[model samples]
Target chain A: MLKIDELEKCYRNKEKRSIFHTTKSKEEKKALDGINIDLKEGQALACIGENGAGKSTLIKCALGILSPTSGSVRLFGEDPRRNKKYCMQKVGVVFGQKTNLWIDIPVIESYKAVKQIYKVDNDTFKRNYEMVMELLELKDIIDVPARRLSLGQRMRADIGLVLLHGPELLFMDEPTLGLDINVKYTIRKFLRQLNQQEKTSIFLTSHDLDDIDEICDDAIVISKGKQIYSGKLDELKNVYADKHIIKISGMKTGNILSLFPGVELTEKENQSIISWDKSCYSVQDVISGVFRMYAVDDIEVREPDIDEVVSRIFTEGVSI
Target chain B: MKNFWTYLKISIKSKLYYRTSFILNMISPIIVLCGQVLLWKGIFKLNNASDFADMSRNAMFSYILIAFVLNNSLNWSTENSLSKDIRNGTVVSKMIRPTTFLSQNIADMFGGVLIQGLFYTLLVIVIFFIAAKDLFVPSFSNLLLFVLSAILGMILRLMINDFFSLLCFFVTGYLGIAWLKNAITNFFSGAMIPITLFPVTLKSIAGYLPFKYMIQVPISFFLGEYTFADGIKTYTVQILWILFFIILHCLIYRKIRINLVIAGG
Candidate 1:
């Protein structure tokens, strides 16, 4: 479990003042401000944000890698800043862009080093190593040096190395970045199982919305160093996303435009797509009206996906 | 301690993985040692001097060989590596580990130099046996003393290097800092030239500084230049300097960690 309250981090920025740059000034740039999060054991939370939006800074603060400018972060009910080594014993972190495995050594060697470093007992090491190897599909790549591995292979190796100690909490910053869809899916599935079956808490940040959609139940949206929304991913889509799209394919699609007033409709050769605002018309009423109007070959209703919902929240500055 | 050994093992394994590069690195130092020896021999022949600074030609040659080996044992740019890690953001991996930063870096430094250390050490023994058998051999007790001093010297060197490497966190570039450290260490530690050959003023200055303890003091013990009492005194000073650097390292690291910034996400 982890808790962050009013956690703020400010970095000093140096600015050159004169044309010759003889004078300089120091300014404070807030990387994170008034951010709060409480991740319980076995809960997987997605931290959604734009670039430079302080997601990584928040993780560093929580991990005691960076001291917060104000407020506090507690890991397992202890101030991480004061007790970082103790807190880190039960914590695992993976930066997708950077590797934790030693680049020149085989993946298995690095895992063994991690085992010794974390003082994991032989039994625990064996159990976790087997589970991680099986779940991450790392058996083939285990003997390869990290530098020779492809990006996906290296990432899988990194994840396996981090899990070899059976950390109670995992902080992953873009764990699936720059990977093919297959590898990403594999990693997400592995993480989901880790959370659900093993009861390990996950705090993840990524630009991939699908990663969030598939792996997390709760979500926190941040933009420009501030938390904009924090709640269930389902509620985020339902509340912020007002438009429901319906596609109807039939021979008589020409007159569908005038049938529904206030609803946006796009007519094609054989298909008519209706964009219905939930505020203006109920989905049930719209579907019934469409069915009563004409014979349809096929009709499908689609709610906004998480990608659209999150993009809307960011662009429209929606907050709750 | 277990973490330290593990990191050391990993570091050595990583280095050995690049088989060609590791072999080249090991051989390159021999070329430099040979060059230095030839250059010194020319100087001695040109001057037509049987001895320089009260050391015979064979003694000085032995000094150069031993010094070269010892210097290579401590040859690693901790600052360069640390700064690169800081710049590339790989330092975050180190920060999140369950071990302290000091232990990891120390293990890594020693591990990186271990192979070279063993290689140079064997080279020195072979060269001494094949080419310089007439060179003075220390008593077994003196050899034991030399080993102790050399171990302490290695510790002292690592401590000094670690202290300087921590400064990389405060600077954007480590080249200037590393150059300064190397210049000072090379000049004062007698790695480039034995302290016995230094002028009175330079020798006194070296005595006041801790760098001499890292190289010259241990080599002095090896060559029986120091009495038993002198060896004891040298150790006392080495331990004190090590203690100083340890305290300074801890204090500076604490300050640096407050402002630690990993360059990339």
Candidate 2:
């Protein structure tokens, strides 16, 4: 539903040579370095990157909030900048720290205002408003002034407002950041349900790795404004999931590192662990070997969580 | 039109959310009006020329009252809102909305004027009518002229304010500049004193500036200083200035939009 080509956003920093003299200087900070990506209809793409990696800049360009210094962004078949109204009608964006609802106004009033801005018909407005309020559990807080609501409540209200108009494309930046665990789970569940029911195309950014794992079907990892990896979530897990740690509480340490030529041993006070790098041996073969060499009491091997995988990618700075 | 009603409702709800603020807000304008009345009354007594240009103490008070109302009605601080939106990055989402920013701001202004300006105007009119009954009462025709001129003047002021506010898209830290513009407009627009009280040369110069239309022209119409022909000429000039500023505002906004794209704001 969205396509970008060679998008680069650059800012010129003007410096004064001297206060009295008439000389000027300049430097450029290129926030995004020629990023290109496409999102298929109904696909949830999570943009993973560090701060200042140009993720926000890239989103702004796609939403036509900021014009790219170079390159083009197209929503559907048309340029977003040129057909801004049509593009706006097809997109719903939630800024991490900013709520579009007027602060001192009641939540319902803000929704009414959004309805007018989107020009929704009466029946659709009524039906969607009820559905959104019910889905977000905002019916009770709908009459409360937005300023009086908690951040989590406000976030839900803001999301409800975005869904009121039923935009096909949704942009959620750090939606779960700073939110409590319960709120995060509620938002994640609602997002999954919305995507399933409406077939909405979601572009989400989150510092919470669990959020990405729960809802994202596809992922793109960018670092320092460069796209390092783009593929299905499972594919990333397979390609990068080389090692599986079998945590065994055995009171024995027979140079566990010597089990395999390349195995890394991690020993605790009463436990010894070894990582079976898939590059060296299959899980079944490693298990069989461990059974033969040492008494295996209990063992459980599983894929590393997204947090570990992402931390590795960042710390290792691997190039995909 | 639906958005207009919705915005008005939201604005009202927003303003009423803080009862203390609403009460304090109502008191502020009255205090300002009293200050002006005292300052101008002192000047008129000292000059001992209350009847100059057919302007008595009562006429002067009436003119000041209307001028105060008109000034508040025309008060549109573009710099404040623009700078805030920029700092918060909320302007990004605002731009993505299908509504025009100018229209939204103008609608906001109407809401403000209705809630704050109308409250002050009504309160002052009631207080002045009782306490300063001798102040030259407005004729129906003068009232009509005053209303039209004030509306046009507000439109012109909004255009000018919007133009200056758009400068934030390029210039950094313009809070002081916006305040300076407001101060200049307040002084020269006749919110402080009638332009007629100024020296002839200054009054003639102020006559041409859009600032004068915002207060002086509207006040003069209410004070019955101008005949129908003179009122027409004065208002026609003011309307032309309003049209010019509106066009200028749109042109500059378009240019600054392009500049924003280039500068990556």
Candidate 3:
């Protein structure tokens, strides 16, 4: 439901002259360079990038919060800036660092305010509000002021506040930022369920890989404001996930290293870990080979984590 | 309208959230009013027959009290909160809404003025009523004009404040701007001293500028100092200035969208 073509954004920086400065100098910095992207209807797209990678810049330009220095963004086949009111009606946005709810009001009061502001009819409002509160587990804390809520509680409330309007598309910037594992898991599962049941298109940008695995089907990797990889998440994983982890107990690192000519082995208390390219040998073959060579113990074979794959892609480039 | 009311309710609820702080805020304005009362009464007594102007002592007191209330409303601090919204990216919340910047600001002003400023003004008014039974109660016609002028004055203040709030995007100087506005309005809107008290050139400058209409003219109309013709002329000028700032707010907002629009910055 969103399209960006050759998007380029340049920010002008004025020199921070001295305390008694005389002249004004300007420098142009490129925040986004030649970005082209399209997100189809009902697809949850993950924007993978480190900080300052222009993910926010791209989203802001699409949402019409920021005017692009060049190129165009079309949402639902119309310019977001031109049809902002109509577009915003169907769009829900959340910034992890900020809240849309009133600072000192009960969570439910904020929900009621959302219902009023969106002009939702009473029946629909009741149904949606109850559903959101139940799904987000907001009932017990609904009467508590937002200022008193924990970060996780507040993020859930913020999500529910936006979802009360039943938006067709949701944009979340770092939605799981600085959150603990339990809260992050709750949000990830909630988002996945919402996307599945409602067919809601989601645009999510986060550094967390588990969130990506749980909620998103499509992936776009951005590095230095340039599109590096834009395709299926599994394909990105398969290409970069070539190594497998093997942990063996009752084995010495010296014996394992001698068996394999050029393998990196790490040893812990009673176990040795060996990492090797899957392309070089199959897991079954390695298991049999290790069993034939080594005596008694336990062995575990694990696939490389998605985070490791992504980190490799980021550091090693898209050369695989 | 429903959205604005909801926002207004929520805003007032926010102010009322800290009950003790809310009560504490009511004291400062009353204290300031008492000081202004002492200072103005002493000046009148020191002037003896009031040789400086044709205004009377009762009229001067009424002007001061009414202008005190009006100035309090005019200089309400929506811009300070707006600057925070911009800095912290909470402005994106407003952007995601169906409303414009002006609507959001108007809702905020209603919250700040009708609660934060009105409480103190009402307390001081009660003190005034107990102290002076024979003092000014505006006539029906003056009351009608006063209400209209005050409404427009509020809109004008919001527009001016929103305009400068937009400057926060470029300058990042909210405190300086706020103090400058406070100083200028105090000097020009005549909360501390009426424009009649100013020398000839300063009075002429006040006449051309819009700050007097915000506080001084409203008081003049309330005090029955302005004739019907004079009131209508001044109201028309105030309306024109309101329209000017409304357009100016839109222009400045466009500039902000072009140059600012911070998200996760």
Candidate 4:
């Protein structure tokens, strides 16, 4: 479990004074401002933000890698700044851009080193090592040096290394960034299964919306160092995803727009795509009306995905 | 202790991973050692004497050989490596683990130097056996003292290097700091020239500094130049200096953690 209350972090500018400008600048830039998050046991929380939105900063502050300027952060009911070793013993962190594995050594060697570093006993090390190896599918690359592996392979090895100690919580920053679609899905599935079966709490920050959709249930949206939205992921989708798209392909669909009062339609060839706000028009009524009045060969309905909902929130400044 | 050994093992494995580089590094030191020996021999030849500064020709050669081996043993690029880690934000990996940063760096230094140290030490023994069997062989007690002092010296060197390495957090580059550290340490520690050959004033000043203990004093113990009383006095100073740097590192690191700006995500 983790608790962060009104956490704020500010970085001072390191501007050199010129001969013409003798006075030093004392300006401080806030990377995180009055942000709060409480992640319960076994809860997977997604920190959604764009580049430079202070999402990484928040994770660093919570991990005691960077001290907060103000407010407090507690990991397992202890201040991480003062008790980093104690908190870190139960925590696993994976920085997607950076590697935790020793680059020149085989991935298996790094895993063995982790076992000694964390003082994991033989039995537990064996069990966790086997589980991580199987789940991360590290059989082929385990003996290769980390520097020789691809980004996806290295990331998988890193994740496996951290889990060898059986950490109670895992903090991942863009775990699937820059990976192929298959690799991304593999990582996401591995993480989801870990959360579901092992009950390891996950605090994930990623630009990839699908990672969030697959791995996290609760979500907090950060923009400009501010917590703009915090609630259930489903609720966030429902709130900003108010519009639905209905695509119907037929020969004569030019007059479909005239039948619906507030629907927008675009026709290309034999396909007519109808879009409308669900709050204004009942989907069932509209579908029945179009079915009765128009000749339709094929029809399909689509709801807004998390990616579209998040884009809308950012562009429209939707907050709750 | 477990973490320390784990780090040491991993560091050794990494250093040995690149065979060409490791072999090259091992051979480079021998070339430097031979070059230094020839240079010193030429200096003695030019002086037209079998002794300089109360050291006979054989004693001076032995001193050079031992110093070369000891200096190579203590050499660690902690500052450069740490500065790189800090600049690139890879230092976070070390910080997040449940191990002390100082111990980890110390292990890495030892791991890196272990192979070279052993090789050079064996080379020295072989050279002494073939060239000068009776050249400055210390008594058993003195050899024990020398071994203890040398271990402490290695630790002292690591502590000093780490102290300078931590300054990378505040600076953009480490070149200047490293140059300054090397110049000061080499001059005062007698790694460049034995403090015994210095002018009276310079030698006295070196006597008061911690750098002398890092190289000259330990060599003194190995050469049987230090009495029991002298060994005790030198050790007291070495321990105090080690403690000083350790405390300073702890204080500075505490401040650094608060202001640490990891360069990249």
Per model, kept true contacts as a fraction are: 0.78, 0.59, 0.66, 0.81
Q: Write the candidate numbers in order of decreasing lDDT.
A: 4, 1, 3, 2
The segments of candidate 4 whose C-alpha lies over 4 angstroms from its true place after superposition are A18-24, A247-254, A267-272, A293-301, A313-320, B74-79, B200-205
Candidate 3 second chain TM: 0.91
Model 2 CA lDDT for position A102: 82
- For model 4 the local lDDT of residue B91 reads 81
Indicate which candidate wins on DockQ. Answer: 4
Query: What is candidate 2's lDDT per residue for B1-265, written digit by digit as tens?
Result: 6656666666566666788966776676668888988887787778888675656888887887777777665334322565566655566656767766666666665666677777768876896669766588878998888888888888777777767666667766667668788888887888887777888888888866779888888777787876688878877888898778767766765555433532222
**What would the per-residue lDDT of candidate 3 be over residues A1-320, giving only the tens digit for each residue?**
88999998888877777679776788887888888889887899999987788888888888887778899898888888778778887889988878877778888888888888888888888887887887788887889999899988899889989888888899988899889998898889889998998899999998888899889988988888888888888888877787878888875423655556666778778777778876776677766667765663888877457798778877877644
TM (chain A) per model: 0.91, 0.86, 0.86, 0.90
DockQ leaderboard ranking: 4, 1, 3, 2
- Interface RMSD (Å), every candidate: 1.3, 3.2, 1.4, 1.1
lDDT of every model, 2 decimals: 0.85, 0.76, 0.79, 0.86
Candidate 1, residues A222-279, lDDT tens digits: the string is: 8999988888988988887889988987766335446678888788887888897788
Error of 3 at B263 (Å): 7.3
Worst 10-residue lDDT window, candidate 4 chain B: B73-82
Query: Distance from true position, residue A97, model 1, in Å?
Result: 0.7
Where's the lowest-lDDT run of ten residues in candidate 4 chain A? Answer: A250-259
| lDDT of the structure predicted as candidate 3 | 0.79
* TM-score per candidate: 0.93, 0.88, 0.91, 0.93
Instruction: For residue B78, give model 4's deviation from the true position in Å.
Output: 5.9
